[model samples]
Target: MMICEINSHSLPVRPRPVQGEATIGFLMRVALANGYETPRQLWIGLRTFDAVCKALCLSAEEENTLFGPFPSYWGHNDFKYGLTAADFNHSLMRWCPLCLRESAHLRGQWMLKLCCVCSRHSIRLLDRCPICGSTQRLERANFDRCICGAWFANAQYVDTDVESVVRITQTLEASIFDKVALPSLPSLSAQEWLRLISYLGQFSETFQPAKPGKIANTHQLDTAMSLMFNIGWLLDSWPENFHVILETIQRKEAAKLSIRRTFGSMYRVLYVDLAEGCFQFLRDEFERYLHEYWRGVVSKRNKAFKPETVATHPRVTLKQAAQKTGVAPAIVSHIMQSELIPYGLVDLPSGRKVRSIHKSNLAQIKALMNGCMAIGEAATLLALPECRVRELISSGIITPLISRVHDKSAAWLIAKQQVQRLFFTSSEPRNVFSAITVRRLLKYWHLRDGEFMALVQALSESRLVPVALQSTPVSLGNVTLDEQEARKWLEEVRFQVGSSMSVDEAAKRLCLKQQVVYDLVRRGLLVTIEDKLPGRRVMRTSLEDFQATYISLAEFSRSLQRAPRWVLKKLHVPPISGPLIDGSRQYFFRRSDVCSEALRVD
Candidate 1:
């Protein structure tokens, strides 16, 4: 028939193309209008539907709009738009009975993987014939009739809560057509949204419960949609809520194993363009779970550092050696400075000379340097003044393996075990006190100056033996104690008092200022007992409590034997209730916190 004659003979009941209708669906409608038995019959040849459109008096733009694939129809180049012929299944066409009854045609949106529900009727689309349970075919002349001779228009329709489905549809439509600006998710672009949808589909297929074989129908689409909805919520809040989901997933052992088996790693599941924000979130989540959940699965083998054998003298640069040995570059430099490792400047092809160490000597140097400390480091480790350490060295009490620098100074590398041995050997007597205690005892005894001087002179010559002090800095001087014989004489001379004492007595016992004791009481840090005569007296038990619970930050750093900045950086301070002490921002850490931190540092 002539094109003009065919146009005149076109069916009077030609329906307008529905929004987001598939090319196949539109072709089917045109076929029905032109008295064709089926859409396939209207095709002149493979992929040639121009003849049918020309005969029907359809314009080029209208024909292209109705039948063109993605980029032309959806205004995007990506096949993820779900417009290709392969995207639809001729043997398994899904349809909403209510939608078909109202529009008398199928929509292109229904053919997409994302299209799980009918937005108009708020009902799930069915793929199988309701009565016979046979999958519906799309080749039928009429869009509403099933292969089983069932008219789906008369089939019972079930209502559904299509809120998620509606949202998914709107988001997909907005992304595809650039319809509306989604301010909530400003980081997402149209392409990224499309990729996210594609990823959801792939992820659902990978992790979904295994059946006998692959089935592409409403069930698969529903699972993908459900996953997309949940993932959408996760992406909305990102890492915080995402971390919660990961924790939950990790708790279910079976699910965790399934996920690992299916995806292998989180990175595999989230592979996408690095520029995408979703990619970063997924990567961070993956890394977090990698450490927390998949640590056991990861290989822990150390990579050996091997220098190139091409050179006559095989050597590695300081930075390269550091990386290979898993040691910091600064530490490696210190080792070189100490002359523990033989190093020299090597000429590079770039005409620059760089310091390098021979590979053969690295092992011996690393072993010698391991758990060893320098003179200053040893003093800090031993909690003694550097001068005291020097005196001990001079007296041959603490011997060190000294490495001589380039005719400048020697780097004393003391073995940590030796330092520990010497530190623990000289134990301080808990009852022993400094010279201040002798004066207090003399005053308590009501001794006269001449008697005290004669007693002090005698005690200084005989009973006053030097002892290694605890807590106090060496600059303050070593602690001196009365000999065992002198202790018996002192007991007979001075009266023993109860544990609870006055603030002045507490200050002498604690080696702190009386004003400091009063300040502690004022700050509610030190418990005190009320006394009408002495004003307020701090109990000895309260002093002991203060000693046990709190220590000045400086003392804390000394105990740790690390720099003040290092201590502050490592300490994770717990929330405290009250305001800090006035004047200086002097921190007083809980003794328990210090002990725990010490253990961690060690």
Candidate 2:
């Protein structure tokens, strides 16, 4: 008989790290340096600052000094002291096109304004020249400085001066203004529009027109961009479409320019910050639902085998296939887009066919699907869960499959498709889990098993279930014990899946002077969750795996057909562990030590 036990255990939930006061200060410095100048960004900074202060249990006055409106450092002129050039450098390293080498200008000469050959007049045309700057004679010199003329004379041809930096910033700003318009058009989706809005705001902060008596700081480009968005003049219109939004914003900007020109970018940022609450509201208001309504189709499984032979093969539905595979129906639809399978085969209702590659070919398929070679085997071969493989499937973009597989006790299997899908490297499915799907599932539906069969059921059907080979903690019989002995025995067993021998018996068997058995439990070699004789919570210890510790490098070298030096290099082991012979012509190494090092590397 088998049992599915729920411990009724509500595991302690660790809270997400809330930003503290110091972190808020750090963030403010970062934002100031990174071009987070818009009113929106300031609001976000203030909220973050306030929350952090509250988390740190700061006094009301201290909180006010840090994040309060008007007189606070955040709103005062002195806030710039908290930020530095290094912060600017770090920000540029992450998001700036020029600093990160993501700009198209790196590849070739970028035409700024067309200059005439006489150096007197300039035009916006690409082919024609501005003043003395004829398109033909135009030597593509790196902009060494801003219009102020500072130059970087390094052999690497990299410019570090603020003047040239400002020119590039202006160029990007112009690109955004010319190519992209505010509130965009209805032709673009809401998500695309939102993304563009944020991108524009970011670009504006990075590039602002230099003011009189103010030196341009490449480090402060991030701040400038933020300020531009806050001023609202950067946006000409918020039209519902291409023609309307652009015209409106342009008209409004022209009107504003004609009026008092006192609207400095910094003042504009201050205005916006006062209006918008900060980052959270922006995120919530602008979040786009990137998922589309996918129509599920009924299709036959690609089981090429004879129907009678594989009949009771337990068909997994289309929804189930999506769940198990960690793939979207749309993506599966893309795979089988137009590829037809044999008729009369089992398939899902949404035109999705049940496909099966030969177990031998599974490895090849997995390689094409995911990068890892043996991961699919860990789930399919080892009978682990689908959730275990999802992270590996998603890679670093989301939770790693390793996180799911690790249950703080033992690894278990979830879904075979998750295993196969994650391990197959050639192709990958994107946007498999949509926010809406997750939200709906979590909000209303109960979580169901995504796998085709349970572990025991699958093993039972195949008759491949492992039999007891050696004495493990699970296999041990409990003996009579006093309370102290029982406590000692319990201390010797920790929960380790696939471990054998009862906790008490294993403790009894290992009669050591010190707490060696207890050490194993602490190190996660034993599992003490199972019910023992007389109803005590006792578990078992898994057999010690030598692969975890030993690998013979010398033997490995001998097995390789390649040159010994090549094998040694591949093994990444030191060639010698003993004193060198005369003139370093030869050296000696301990075979045992080499093997030991190889084991550690593995």
Candidate 3:
């Protein structure tokens, strides 16, 4: 249509960029002065004008000031500012009636999500038209009137104490736009304040009442501003004030969940460098609560909040170190106990002691472990009995490079090179075989599986191999075996099957389920002796005594003519005074007690 001269002084309004005016707001003023109907039309016209000019005359800084304000000022690449017409309501634009009446223009500050109340007038910003009860769209034909033909200048206002919010907004703006230091909030720099408010705004949006669209309500805006203000106040006093806030919110479950979720979000956002001054109060509280709640929830999944002891030599706790090394906490503890990786004990202010390792040592630990394998892993790789592997270690044929933790059953780390050397150069011609292979060999030799296993147990108990090199006392279902050695032993020795057997074998002999036998042993009705090779051993006499002296709950119920479930319910309430049977799952009663209780119930 018609072209207007393109200079700041030549424009009709010559409106200077106000302190809080967003670039889009300034563009809106330009469209109005140029007699355009809407901001959308203005955008189209500008694109067409740029085409005619052959090159976009707007400098990079100028274009950024207009459309890039939100993302650029917030310092986040992924955050969408929603400056276009489709996202107009997402920003929750608002205005003060008094300010509009005085200046006859919208300020950029009013477009911010955190700008809820007018600092100058001490009143809440009105986003919806009071007369028609519709959200003011601001794209209307005129500046001071709504789409429904209501004048915003005439809307009612309510008094509010938004001084703190106003101060925070002003401080953030000065710090971000002007690069000025905020002397009042000395603990946080300008960038930190921006990040803090950004987080607060995102959190506040979650509290908004359910609505039809993505736009937030005015009340939601007020709540967000209040939250940000209170957070700013808390920062003045730091961790002490933070604890007070936590105590106050503990009674409110929704608030507590929200705060906990927010802490997790902060951890993700802040990443691994959580220092003393970075959101001092929030960071401290985050770490404290994280330590308390970490076991089942965040400990395994999150690694962002690991505290750094020093800048040059950063240290991580045992749990964190384990996570970095991709191993278990017990393994890390064992490594520290053996002095393989140097570590120190830190006494916390809460009177708790924690073992911490330097981050630089993580690579060293990984390298050391890489060259070695645990005893079980080595056994699997070499296809040898775990017991035979231990024998080699004891005989000094394969010396373990790392020792086990004292009083703990954690496996020792042995150099893989030594094991390989022993396997290749040994005169015995060792043949690594799995349990399946051992079973085949037993079949080939015409020996029964039970009798051969019993002989192996006797050999294990004869103190021929040190306890450290013994096959683990647990089941040998997954154990690797030395086939040549096992074949030689079977050919050389003749052994007798014992009168007693393992719990599983006992269950089969007594014509009862395995769990039933375990229940009897748990309740002290049947006694067991601990054996090094095959774990718990049960005597035939003990099983016979249990069969004679104790009765099942079902039998007891039938004897008393009562329902089994009813009897079980009564027994569970005030539980019997003895060790729990089946870890509190099944309860056993002596036949005499069962008879007396049955009679009493009858």
Candidate 4:
């Protein structure tokens, strides 16, 4: 009989490790071949497993095959694409049913969360069993049979019709498994391609808010999969459509003067990070586009605009021109009205009308407001406390070009973005990190050995998008920004999801050794949940795949290369279950003595 007997009976079937088989997969096969329910039941310790391998006289290649290219880090799969523990699909079994029916060996690449499609069969991988309506457990006795007595090979799956998903998966597979460059993706290393895709995904899809700090789960993995949506389309076109991405980022930046301060983390990733030389074309194009077309307002009074920017975008408001030259605002307005100076009256977004001054006429408005301003006026200008301004002077941060600090009433000043530049949160989804306000970012958050400008760029780029919107104009003290960068995505999202259970309790439920359970939980090989309560909880489903008592017609059709219904009709045998009788799509045939009385085929 094909019925799996999971008792004390020990019929050892220690097989040679296949070249591309995963370690956990080898253990699963070894246990099942010997009629054991789980691999841990067949061994006392990892030492015993090693001893069995020693007895087998396995070669070094075999060892590497079974344990992965790196045995030490094999438990966590850090070897694959520089992803963290939460980014992989190690928590649950993701299977290509047809592949299991054909080879009955697990492929290591399936562990990647990006490996959603099975190219060989052109079908989406099945996570939940069709019959049981539950996610599969790795502890089953049979690969083909689900614990619910349904055949995996017969389970109908959704086809991967999306060309981008298929192409991207294939590209990733080739890079990871074969250790080659992406077939046609813009000249980037395998790891860099992954990074580029991830950053772009984070930038583009800010509308779908993720539960930040609570990283990956089954649902979250699905969300992560969605992140790969337009990556293929973007890469297929290369730098040609790259401007579309830049435009998207620019729309989010509240700061318009400096690209570094405005584009934020996005800027650092492209230009500051030297290793990303493959993105040089993008950086060059970005600079070119800004120099020729950008019209950011400039003024000697604002100081935010660089000397280079004045030559590039020299337009300044009448009030700013007056502030620069110490001339009255009315005189600057009157000069523009009389057409004595080359200028235009521009309507601001806030509905205020202001005359703009030309670059040639800017010398007429040259003056300094810094030294003469009172401490209160300087405090208001810099959006800081008088004490903080004094401290800044003491710290040598406040440069006195015109102010004499010995005069107690005199104060130094710099223009601030002020209340008009106040930040507001959008329903548009940003990133998977907890949002920190610009106010918080500029004032409260501390980064020891971290770049402060990078955080500012993240806020400006909306990577660490606004969470709180101010209804009334608030001071710079209230606009918040917490740390956000490419690296921060992996570091910060650590909130506990679900509840907890003891290790001993988890080990027994999952049919694993206590030590094995410990390793799995630590490495995130299994789905580990943390609550504020106690230890992490392990949600191990039951392992009851006894045997293949019945066969589905789909399985028969696969072998016979005929239609399922034709194969079923030609068999001339009554089925145990069918679409007509039990509403099950599959037609199951009893295998003689084990399930029913024997029947002979014509």
State each model's C-alpha RMSD to the native.
21.6, 32.8, 20.4, 38.5
Please report the TM-score between candidate 3 and the true structure.
Answer: 0.37
Candidate topping TM-score: 4
lDDT of 3 by residue, 471-495 (tens): 3332222223555555445433431
* Residue 402 displacement in candidate 4 (angstroms): 33
lDDT of each: 0.54, 0.30, 0.54, 0.53
Error of 4 at 70 (Å): 11
- Assess candidate 1 and give its lDDT: 0.54
TM-score of each: 0.40, 0.17, 0.37, 0.44
TM-score, candidate 4, is 0.44
Model 2 lDDT tens row, 464-573? 22222223211001111123422332233222333245545565544321244344444443334544334323333232332233222343555554454555555544
Model 1 clash pairs?
21-108, 22-108, 71-76
- Model 3, global lDDT: 0.54
Which one wins by TM-score: 2 or 4? Answer: 4
Cα deviation of 516, candidate 1, in Å: 63
Find the 10 residues in a row with the least total lDDT in model 2: 114-123
- TM-score, cand. 2 vs. native: 0.17
Put the candidates in lDDT order, highest first: 1, 3, 4, 2
- Per-residue lDDT of candidate 1, residues 468-551 (tens digit): 445442321222344454444543233233334567766666666677666667777878888654567766567778988887
